[model samples]
Target: MVQEIRWGIVGLGSIAHTFAKDLALVTGGTLTAVASRSLEKAKAFAGEYGVAHTFDTYDALFESKEVDVVYIATPHTSHEALSIRAMENGKHVLCEKPMGVNPDQVARMIAVAEKNKVFLMEALWSRFNPSIRKAKQLVESGEIGSVGFVHADFAFYALNRDPDNRLLNPDLAGGSLLDIGIYPIFLSYLLLGMPKNIQASSHLYKTGVEMQTSMIFDYEGAQAILYSGLNSKSEMKAEISGSEGSIFLSPRWHEAQGYSIEKEGELVDYNLPTKGKGYTYEIEEVHSCLASGKVQSSMWSHRNSVDLARLLYEVRQKSNIIFPFEQQKEGV
Candidate 1:
């Protein structure tokens, strides 16, 4: 068994930095290498993290014999290509959420992983969060008494950011749907499973990027109301209601530190704080899977990622959401 798991991080962006910081907190993983299109960026990040190697290109990083796995933190559009290349080089991958731009892209990534016989998992950290996991247990134990409805929204005001930034740049697959919207959808799927039907609406900015989206997922006997936005800020809370009581997740619920359950007019809150931005939990999961020779995480498997991508693409279809590149490719 490979006792010490070596990690290489591609993309020296904010999320990558956060993940790298948490990787240090993991027991068996070491940040041995870093990579980016810019060597200076990679070197700077490596220096801060006490990393030993830096690669100017992802190909160099994936070809590294030292790195057992890699974390892909680049833009949404690059996830498929980067992950395919990494897996082809025999490096396990822990990709950032949404997995890909759509279900098709995600499927292709999975096929490559299978062909390479390497572990691959979407870094949907919320699925492994302590508080969220507890909530799942509570709900499954009938603490919530058969879920009837779910409500979650993740939003923030980012209109002032540069138009070219990822949040607003259509070229980078920018949109509220693929970014923050996936969280609410994931919560719904986690608790309620796939919906029987979906109703959605979206608002777009002048640059053709989706600014906000509203979704209604209909299950057999339950429903989920979800939203995501960048034009304005929201409470970022989440709620799940059942016949006997209601469960509430704190603001910024995706990374919620605590949650409450209300039964018969009495509300009880529970605190389950995360360790190191909550990415540590998923990092540990990847380590466990790799150590055991597993090709996917049981918690957030490839199937879950594909389903989430399908939900996203479905919402886009119903809401008439289309990106510039997609339109061009389709010759619209």
Candidate 2:
């Protein structure tokens, strides 16, 4: 019999709600506890998930022995501190994407994870996504011989969103680059590895946060054209083209349910539906790693996260995007 891995979630935001719902669809793991700054919010979330514990403060939950692992689902600005505290408290951590506001923060989080000797992973659900995985496998197997180009984009209109919203608020490190841009960037890195040279440009919102970013990642003989924006809706399609064929992840490709392969002038499609809201796959990955006594997932290692952070930070630097918290580090 497998022992159930106890799961706790911090931050009861919209994404957290989605994650909690998907957690129900996973097996060998149970939502043991939930924490929020507001006791009412914690209790409400706990009631919905049948979580055994609820804490008004994150520190309270971190202190509780009931939680074996904590999922940090808060905004990008809070990920570093929350995750470090959880690891320091002897709890494993699965933090949401982008992991931190900058490479420095991410390094701090990783250092704490290493020092604590606890499991830590950036919850990049797409890395564990079935369709994305198949596409990567096909590329690796030479189905897409000698990759030459990769293009992906994720965008949706949020310019109308109030300035106070995290999507536009510089205080929360809000922007298209860190929020949606990471998806396309992740795809580029997954298939193409690091770029030798890069070119990037970003359009800023009224709030001083970037609303749009376009990037060109240059590899040895390959290039990836990526774009993300909050000013308009994008096609949300992603394609990886090589000398022989191309792999097309369908619309809204980040969480694509299917993918197509075009080879020898023929296109073949494959359906690989996710179990629930896509978070279930990542939840299962966490379960597997914990069961195996692994500190990081092979699918998305800590090095991968660090590399991704560096890429993000570099892009921000090239595009002149800086969060309020990082301005001091920038000597501004």
Candidate 3:
């Protein structure tokens, strides 16, 4: 019989609820605990998910013996500290994207995880999506033949949202770049690796967070054009063009269910549906890594998180987009 991996969730936000529901679908994982600043909120979430433990503080959850691993779904600014705390307490961690607000925090998180000998992975679920895996395989197999350019955009209108909301608050590291833009950037990096150069621009909100951002990643012989924004809605599509053929990831590309390959003017569609809000794939990855006694996922390693954070840092630097906390940290 396989030993169950007991899981703790460090935030009771909507994303955490989604993760909890998906955790139920993983065979060797159990949602043993959840934490929130409010004990009432934690209890409510735990009751909804049948979790046996609840904590009013993140530190309590980290120290709980019921939790073997923690899913850090807190705000971007809190990820580094919470992940390190969990690792220091002998718990593995799967942190949400952006991992940290910047590269330095990511490095610290990685260092602590390494020192503690606990598994740590960024929960970039799209990387584990079946359709994305297929797309990568097709590109690697030369089906796209000498890929030359890729374009992706993720955008949604949040103009009417409250200024204090996380999406609009610089204090929370809110911005399209760190939120939605990371998806497009990830696609570019996965296919092209680090770029030779990065060119970026952004429209900042009155609160100082980026409202919309555009980026161009120049590679040796290829380029990726990416965009993300909160003032408009995009088709949320991604395309890869090559000398021989092209491939298209259907709408909402990041959480894509299918893709198409074009060759000789013929387009063939391949639909690969996901299971359980698509968070299940990453959950299963954590389970597989723990079962293998690994300290980091081979699919999305600690180095990958650092590299991704560095890219985000570069983009923000070029765009003059800095979170309030970062400025405070620098005494700006």
Runs off by more than 4 Å, candidate 3: none
lDDT score, candidate 3, position 180: 91
lDDT at position 304, candidate 1:
92
Model 1 misses residue 110 by how many Å? 0.4
lDDT, each prediction: 0.92, 0.92, 0.92
Question: Model 3 lDDT vs. the true structure?
Answer: 0.92
Model 1 lDDT-worst window of ten: 323-332
Q: Model 3: per-residue lDDT, tens digit, 101-170?
A: 8999999999999899999999999999988888888899999899999999999999799999989998
**Candidate 3 residue pairs in backbone clash:** none
Query: lDDT of model 1 at residue 233?
Result: 87
What lDDT score is found at residue 92 in candidate 2? 97
Q: Cα deviation of 233 in candidate 3 (Å)?
A: 0.8
Clashing pairs in 2: none
